[model samples]
Target: MTLPRIAIDAMGGDEGVRTIVAGVALARRRHEGLRFILFGDEAQIQDALGHHPNLSRAAEIVHTDRVVAATDKPSQAIRQSRGSSMGLAIQAVKNGDAMAAVSAGNTGALMAMAKLALRTLPGIDRPALAAFLPTLGDNDVVMLDLGANTECDARNLVQFAIMGAAYARVVLDLETPRVRLLNIGTEELKGTDEIRDAAAFLRTASGLPLRFDGFIEGDRIGSGDADVIVSEGFAGNIALKTAEGTARFVTDVLRRAFTSSLRSKAGFLLSKPALHLLKVHLDPNNHNGAVFLGLNGMVVKSHGGADEKGIANAVHVAARLVEADLAARIAGDMARVGPILSEEMIAK
Candidate 1:
């Protein structure tokens, strides 16, 4: 089988081309048949690749000097970044030259460029940012609309559930992902009208692979009550940030406690092996990629400050999405969903 090419915006990350090139090399080890189309400054990219000759066998560079700044607003990036490396990489997906595009660029800028260049898929009004978060359960939970759209209506929430489930199928390898609406309470008559409406649709909607498990409260999110958590961006963003902050806080407190005294130091040595396992599970590098779902083409966003390992994980995510045919799965399910539910929503 032939390898699919991935387009990468090599200039956008905080660490620059060296990290991007090295990341690709690392990803190559995981995915044997993957190829690359790298976009960035020619001289700098070449310099970065010099340290990783193994990358050259599967990579090709498309040099462009117009780099999108981390500070650029989405509007500004859409207008001025059309000729930049980020723009070219996105364009590669639009032109079908690459299976997907991966970037560690400005989140706002990448979203703007991707939306403008690739547009949303059919039956999708807005593209959502979806990622898998490590959960207490045996599997990760899929959450969506993370900082993508600040507010979404009933239809939008329902759409998010569908797309989020599609994502879980790929990333989590779930045969049938359970979908839940984020609510203040799990009771039948709680939360906003939008949440209720989405729940109603999911419960009644037919011909889709959705496993509607009713409403799940915020507290239950980490408990793995649902495989896919659907919320508008405002709440989703807050949940994501809060989880991250809490994780860091616990880590800091643990470090301070472990070194507080000689007794604690001895205990720390005894617990070092278990702590190492915990640390590996908590590291963001293991889950570095967040996908933009419902886009016309595939795009994976890496954390801006991600190192080579993180970038490689992000690249691998793009490759996996391509292999799973994420876009086609979403598009197919969407076709079944629209006709079944749109009329009911219109009647309401």
Candidate 2:
């Protein structure tokens, strides 16, 4: 199968060119016909490519020493994006130079640049940041608006639901993804007016390729009860951080307990296999890519501190989304429900 080339911000990650190059090389080894356009310092990228002959043969370099600093705000970053690796990588997507773009850079800056360059799909008011979260169910759950818009109206939440469900369908390979709104309670009447109104809209809207399971409390986020969980950015961001923190806390506690004494050490040795599986499930690297949904083009964000394995996962994510034609899928879904959204907006 012929895959679309991916544009990467080689100088974006915390580890800079070396880690990004190594990760791209790893992804190339794992997936055949994966081409890359590395945006960074030409000499540095060339030096890194020397170590990976396979990648060297399949990759091209677009030199640029300019970078978006971690500390740079979105406002400032947008002004200087044209010459930065992060900006150019996203630009490649808008310019049709690449099918998708991947960056391990400033989240705010990346979002700003991508929005400015790619714009949102016709029916979407704004793009939401969506990512896969490990779940106890057979498939990972998709959550969105992790930090894109702090406050959202009922219309925004409804759009997020559609976008999130479309993403879940592509990534999880489900025909009808079950979706829920993040709320304080699962009761019929709960959350703010926006949540209730959004639920009402989903309940009445027809022909959507999703199953609306109503409001899902924060505590049940990982219960796998729903395939897609939609929320405003403020709450969504807090929920994401809390889940990550809780995972780390659990791992730390287990490590301490396992080394407390000889008895515990013996128990740990006996449970090594189970523990290994648990570790793999909890590792952030396994779920590293956060995609910007509702955008006219595809752009994925890799955690700044992600290692080669994590970065590779991000690249693979971009590849899968491109292969699935995520943008078109979303556009189609939005078009299907455009009339419903318009009526809802008019009613408000």
Candidate 3:
């Protein structure tokens, strides 16, 4: 079996080297043929792996002297920190040293470095962050532009829809996945003129092989209204964070309710297993990463606060996407979209 090599930014996230090293170990144990190139300070990584005999032999490390801080501006970080761990990790993917790159560092910096190093596909203008949201129903939904591009035009939204639909088809194995634009309401005139115009474009677009499901409101996200939801980065980020906050609030309320009294505690004991299962299912950590779609290679962004388990899950997600041949599929799908606007049209 050919093992997939993933480059992990070992110096990223709050847990730093420990979380990344542990995640690599977990990924290797879970997937037989998954290999990793851990990028960071060589001494720290070696020290972290020193106690883990099982993981010491299975992974390789690339040493870097600098690290990109979460607070650094994306453009400046990429420019000034050329030899930083994050930059080096992305470079590994560009050099074909790895199949995918995973990082829990500053998202903007990662995007900038990735775009600078790997570049986008032929027809893609900007890469969007695509994430999976588990719905109440059977099928999951893919939301895009989750804070990658704060302001997007009508054409950008349409492109996001196309890229998201392609992701659903290839990564989620959904044939003819339903695509919907995230809007304020389901009514035709609910959102801005941009959304209205984008809707028109999607309706007439012939090349994208997807089931365009019109508009989907923010409230309907968890209701399973569509298989893929498209939105600008600002709105998408708000929607995602809103959902996460609500989930946390509900869990906390439930915990307090269950511990109120002896009888309640007894009831909680009986319900502990089910609650644990639910928590695992709904925990953001289990689904804490987003893939920067439309790029030449796979790049997954882990939450900066992610722990060992969360980091492991992000790696798992990246490995699964690589195994599914997501990048090639996206390239093929974009190819099928035919000739986009020429440089002149774009300049206009």
Candidate 4:
């Protein structure tokens, strides 16, 4: 079988083609059979490739003069960006030229371009952004709707659950991932109607390849309360951002405390290896890809400011999803829950 190639938007990130090309080199080293289709300015890409001899052979560049701006709104981006690097990269996935597409551009813009070009899956109403979150357990937790679909209905929530669970199966290597809804309380009657309704649907729904472990409050997210936590984009984005901020805050505090005195500095040197491990476990660069799930083709959104390691991690994620055939898994899961969704709609 032929190995899948990943299409990259080389002009999409904060640092431009330099960082992206370096990441391409890193990904090439990690995955020997990987190939890349990069979209950006031919001159700039050529210049950037000079430093990475191996990547130049594995990558094929498609040049476009225009680049999507980070400040561009989703509507404006879609309207004006057909020939832009980001749009062309996503179109590659839509056209079957690439197995998956990766970009570090504007979140709304990438989602818009992907949806406009590739559309949603059979039973999925909308695509949700999903990412891995470091947890107290050995395996990382998967969370969804990080910044897509600010408002979602019960059906959307259920669909997110299905997609998140399928994602967890591949990313976390689980036989049956424990799925949970992010809610105010764990009580049966707590949370909004949609939350309650989604919970009820999962409880009675059969044939899906996940274990619905009821509602989980925000406090338990870092503790690995569930393998997959599903939420609407509004709340999910807030949770994601808050957790990021708290992680930074703790790191900053630790840095300051360890440097405040000579004794503390000596202690820090003594614990350098353990602290390095802690940093690796908490680093966002190690988990830099946010997948736009429910699309017909795979679309991964990398952090705009991500460095080479982060971008390489994002590429790894896209490659893994392609290998796992995420869309097929979603379809299989969706088919099982069809009757439950229809019955609930009829009851409503």
Clashes (backbone N, CA, C under 3 Å), per candidate, total: 0, 0, 0, 0
Worst 10 residues of 2 by lDDT: 339-348
lDDT by residue (tens digit), candidate 4, 1-348: 766789999999897899999987898897777789999999999999999999998889999998889899999999998999999999999888899999999999999999989999888889999999988987789999998899999999998998999899877889899999999999999999999989988898777789999999998998977999999999999999898889889989999999999999999999999999988988889989999998899999999999999999999999888878888887777787766667775586
List all candidate RMSDs to the true structure: 1.3, 1.3, 2.2, 1.3
lDDT of 3 by residue, 84-163 (tens): 88998898899998999999999999999999899998778899999999898787789998999999888788778878
Q: What lDDT does the true structure give each of the candidates? A: 0.89, 0.92, 0.86, 0.91
Question: What tens digits encode model 2's per-residue C-alpha lDDT throughout 106-183?
Answer: 999999999999999998999999999988988999999899899999999999999999998888999999999999
Candidate 4's displacement at residue 300, Å, is 0.4
TM-score of model 4 vs. true structure: 0.97
**Model 2 stretches with alpha carbons more than 4 Å out:** 1-3
- Candidate 1 Cα outliers beyond 4 Å, as residue runs: none
Where model 3 places Cα greater than 4 Å from the true spot, the runs are 340-348
Predicted structure 1: lDDT: 0.89
By TM-score, how accurate is candidate 3?
0.95
Instruction: Report the lDDT tens digits of candidate 1 across residue range 12-39.
Output: 8898789988998899888878899999
Which sequence of candidate numbers ranks them by lDDT, best first? 2, 4, 1, 3
